[model samples]
Target chain A: MKGRSRGKVVARFGLLAALALILSWLESLVPAFFAAPGMKLGLTNLVVLVALYRMGDRAALGVNLLRILLAALLFGNGYSLAYSLAGGLLSGAAMILLKRCGRFHMTAVSVAGGLMHNVGQILTAMLLLDTWQLAGYLPVLWIGGMAAGLIIGLLGAELTRRLPPELFD
Target chain B: MEAKRKRFGRNDLLLVAGLLLLGVALTLALGVNRRDGREVVVRVDGEIVARLSLSEERELPIEIDGRIANRLQIADGAVRMIEADCPDKLCVRKGAVRYVGDGIVCLPHRVVVEVAGEDELGLDAVAG
Candidate 1:
């Protein structure tokens, strides 16, 4: 039983990682209409949130980090890797904290995560370029992040509701 | 488990509403305080290459290492990237920026074009 459960865990992790990678690739195919360069649908985050709720923080962190690294290697460069690492790590941490608090639902947690991700990216940009001028871009980013976060959160909540609880156990 | 069944509770509604309100407030505040930029500063590899007045209407081709990389145009109290050799052409697609703090950056070419001038709200102070 122990061996079977371990295999199941590995299989689940592999499936989630592949799904997240595909979602990330799909998001890249969609051209960004916004003025900001890094803005996107953040579709892969849906998988991260699902992993966080189902398999706990360790699983979520593993899935999130693996997805960013895989996506970076497959389709991006060093700059994209930096941005994704900063954004994904900060957002994942925020989501985990919010989830633990248990005061709000997945939507709210996801919203906060989305906002923090943008903040992390912007901060990274500021550090790389050595300019405070980038802060001017925050208002637009905030608005965009909020809208994207709300949508992702709603979708994540719905997906979590439909999944079998015993599958993760 | 019962709580998971409810998609959104009062806290969720409050959080969403609060975030929306904050976004709108920030947008309005930033929009109102934005001032027309007096100069367009172009940088290559983080070094200042040129400073052009927004009042002047002209096109300047930027060269990096003896190779033309980007074309910058200043007209009608605004600045824009008209052309770039970069594959993505993100800088060209950014359109025109008239506000004091607006910037157009081409990461591939390491080129940055930003507006610099006096504004009612000091972004530097806020960011600092």
Candidate 2:
């Protein structure tokens, strides 16, 4: 019974990955409403956050990674793969870490994840350019992260509440 | 239920406040000390193709004109476009960023104006 349940869990995790990829592609179709470069709705984050709550940690990680790779293949420049990978990994790690904390504040975790993604992306750019000058954008990214994170996080919370616990479990 | 008990610590507020103030200050400083004198380098695919060091001349030579080349200005340590054909002149209106993150981006042109810094020395090692 345990083995069968585990298989079912893995299958569900695969579905989550597919959902994340589709969300990623759909988000790209929506032109950024803001003026800042590199800004996007990041709608895929909703899927990742929801997966984190329902699917268990390994499933969440798998889904996030799969989405990043698939999304890069679908709509991103070849050169941008590294930045996206680094940013996604960093952001996902941040959110997971926050989730593990006793507080487990989903909203705060989302904000932290968003902020870290910006920082991670900027860090990669800085490292690649060998200049700290791009660091100036960090604050802008942080402010933007706050708003985006809050919106995404709250949405995640609502969806999680409505979802059948077994669907995620 | 578990996450709600945690409140933002003082440190978090302080850090956020510091970042905001820094962004505001940098934006203001860049706005006030606008200069018509500076040097600019345009790079694409991490290769430098155009270099413009400012003179007193107000007219700028635009090689690629699209909705992207709104208007150009060189101030302090930066070169920026104050106007553009792009419906969103956010790039043009940004004036010139003297510090890092200050770039002249022609999204339509796929052209970028990035401030060259000491890190240029490491470019060959990484990109090469």
Whole-model lDDT per candidate: 0.84, 0.65
Best by TM-score: 1
TM-score of candidate 1 on Cα atoms, chains taken together: 0.88
How large is the C-alpha RMSD of every model relative to the true structure? Answer: 3.5, 5.6
Query: For each prediction, how big is the interface RMSD?
Result: 2.3, 5.0
lDDT of 2 at B48: 62
DockQ of 2: 0.21
What DockQ number belongs to candidate 1? Answer: 0.48
State the weakest 10-residue window (summed lDDT) of model 2 chain A. A129-138
RMSD after Cα superposition, model 1: 3.5
* TM-score for all models, in order of appearance: 0.88, 0.73
Q: In model 1, what is the error at residue B36, expressed in angstroms?
A: 2.6
Tens-digit lDDT track of model 2 for A54-168 = 7656767788898888878877765467777888899899888878764545666777777777777777776655443454555567678766876888788778777876565
Q: What is the Cα-based lDDT of residue B126 in candidate 2? A: 67
In model 1, state the lDDT of residue A166. 68
Q: What count of clashes does model 1 give?
A: 0
